[model samples]
Target chain A: DVKVTQSSRYLVKRTGEKVFLECVQDMDHENMFWYRQDPGLGLRLIYFSYDVKMKEKGDIPEGYSVSREKKERFSLILESASTNQTSMYLCASSSTGRNQPQHFGDGTRLSIL
Target chain B: AQRVTQPEKLLSVFKGAPVELKCNYSYSGSPELFWYVQYSRQRLQLLLRHISRESIKGFTADLNKGETSFHLKKPFAQEEDSAMYYCALSGQSDSWGKLQFGAGTQVVVTP
Candidate 1:
């Protein structure tokens, strides 16, 4: 069984504040992803890291960034959190192969006030 | 552009009735389709994939390239089978790590 752990299950932050969402995977997968799940919009990718120090922007990369200093950990950073930034953030990891299923964390419900 | 479309937002059926969730995709290259399910208060997990061609939890999905659709079906719906189902397509060949997901369908099984 694979374990993907998010730093927080529920988070609250004020507007204009910096926020960090951490994720760690025990599977040591080579690919890590950050996505925001919204109603009627599905899961939109924000950022993804293929390897340590390598990052790529996804569909909804604006207002967010990512860090992958190590193979097991990936972090999402919100530079200046706003009310609109509130969302359920999900972290997922997958092996370095084609059609590999992504393992997801429990997700963090973020609230920006 | 690659896109995944799950037209149905909600589906309700009796516990013993059959259920189906529709999914479609638009991509120029070969597509790898997948179905993911998220139970109440649980994380999302893979239900099945087109490439694997394996039925899981009594659920099966067939990839119809002619229709560009991959619809999930189950003969007998169970209360525990109720969950959010999402259809996803792998990104371009060069970017297989990325996936485009559908809006998802919430299934409700009534006793």
Candidate 2:
């Protein structure tokens, strides 16, 4: 079974602070994604990396950035955190197939003060 | 624009009762849909995919293009069936498996 590990289960940061959320997948999958899960809005994609050094902005990429220096690790970066950015963040990884199912990590619940 | 929609935010049902979670999507090209479940304190996992056409854990969903709906159904609900359900569409607009997810529905099964 594939395992996706998130660095944190709970995170707290102050407004205007920079934040980093790390995710690692053991299956050597080529695709990685970052999403913010909100109650009414559901999970909205922030950024995704299909390969090392390649990234694409998803629907809700504002206030967020990503890094994929290696295949197994993907990191989401908040250049300047705000209170509105507090939400549950999820990381997912998948193989290179249209029909492949995404494997998700236990999310990090972030609270920005 | 490609999008997925799960209309209900919460669904409460009794054990042994029939349960259905509605999911609808809007996409321009060929569509592939999937249902995901997240149990309490557990990571989200794939429950079933429409392309696979296989029932998982007694839950089955059929894609209806005319209705643009992929409603998940179970004949007899179990106590363990309670969870957060999400409907997702694989994005064809971009190459990689970027998914468009819907606002999830929370199912609660009571005795």
Candidate 3:
């Protein structure tokens, strides 16, 4: 079974605080992604990394950044948390091949107070 | 721009009754469509993909290119089938790593 692990399932942070959400996959997948899931907005991609030290911005990447220092790990960083950023964050990974299904980890629900 | 739309926010059905969840997409290329399900307290997982053309748990989805839709259907709904269903499309040119998802539809199966 493929396993994708998230560092935290639930988190609360104060406004203007810096936050980190970590994700790791054991499948040696070359593709990793960060998305924020909201009530009516659905899942919006924040950022993604196709290789270590390489990252690309997604549709809603204005408030988020990502780091892929290692092949198996990808991290999402919130430079300054805000109330509007409170939402469920999901981490996903897929192989290098095109049209491959993405495997998701248990989401991390973040709340910014 | 590639996009997916799930028309219904909620759908209810009785056990053994037929169920259908509508999904539509807008893309110029040959899109690969998929249905993903997330059960309560469970992670989101793939239920079926259009490319496979196979039924999963008696649920099937057919891609109608003419209509730009890929709707999920089940002949009989079961209690265990109740879950949040998301319609997704693969946009390889944009980013092979991520999947664009719909707002999702909540299915409730009554006994």
Candidate 4:
């Protein structure tokens, strides 16, 4: 079965601290995405990489950055964490084909204090 | 702009009752619609896609292009069926990924 895994299931960070959320996929999918899930807001895409070293900004990319040094891993970076940034972060990956379903990780519930 | 909307925030029903989750989209071209479910403590997963036209877990959805709506329906609700459901659409552009999700609906099933 295809699987996506996150580095942390829960995380707490202080304000102004830099944070990193790591994601890895075992399916060798070419597309990976980072999204923040919140009540009422649903899942808003933050950043996505279609290929290694290639990245595109989603609808809500402010206060976030991403890096894809390897094909299997994608990292979401918060330059300066804030209380408002606290939410459930999800990582997903899919194959190169269009309209294919994305496989998601369990998610990391990040809290910025 | 392409968008998807799931107006209801919550739906409550008794076990064995029918359930319907509505989804509407605003897109000019042919749209690819999908329904995703997230069970308690589980990751969000695809329930079904309009293109596949297959039933999953006794649930099915039909895309009504004239209404621009794709609603999910199940004849009977199970206690385990309670979860958050999201409707999504794909962007027609050249972008590699195709997921523009709705606000989501939380279904609560009673005994």
Sort order, DockQ high to low: 2, 1, 4, 3
Please give, for residues A44-71, the per-residue lDDT of candidate 3 as tens digits: 8899899999998988998788899999
What digit string (tens of lDDT, one per residue) describes model 1 on residues A18-79? 99999999997999999999988999999999999999999999999899999999999999
In TM-score terms, candidate 3 sits at 0.97
**Per-prediction DockQ scores?**
0.69, 0.78, 0.65, 0.68
Poorly placed runs, candidate 1 (over 4 Å): B94-96
Write down the lDDT of every candidate, Cα atoms only: 0.94, 0.94, 0.91, 0.94
Q: How do the residues B6-103 of candidate 2 rate in per-residue lDDT, one tens digit apiece?
A: 99999999999999999999997888899999999999999999999999999999999999999999999999999999999986655577888999
| Clash pairs for candidate 2 | none
What residue pairs are clashing in model 4? none
Higher-ranked by DockQ: 1 or 3: 1
Worst 10 residues of 1 chain A by lDDT: A93-102
Best by DockQ: 2
Model 4 lDDT per residue over B8-103, tens place = 999999999999999999999888888999999999999999889999999999999999999999999999999999998986673576589999
DockQ of 3: 0.65
Task: Let me know the DockQ for model 2.
Answer: 0.78
lDDT, model 3, position A27: 98
Q: List, residue by residue over A50-92, the lDDT tens digit for candidate 4.
A: 9999999998999999999999999999999999999999999
Candidate 3 backbone overlaps, count:
0
Candidate 1: TM-score, chain B only: 0.96
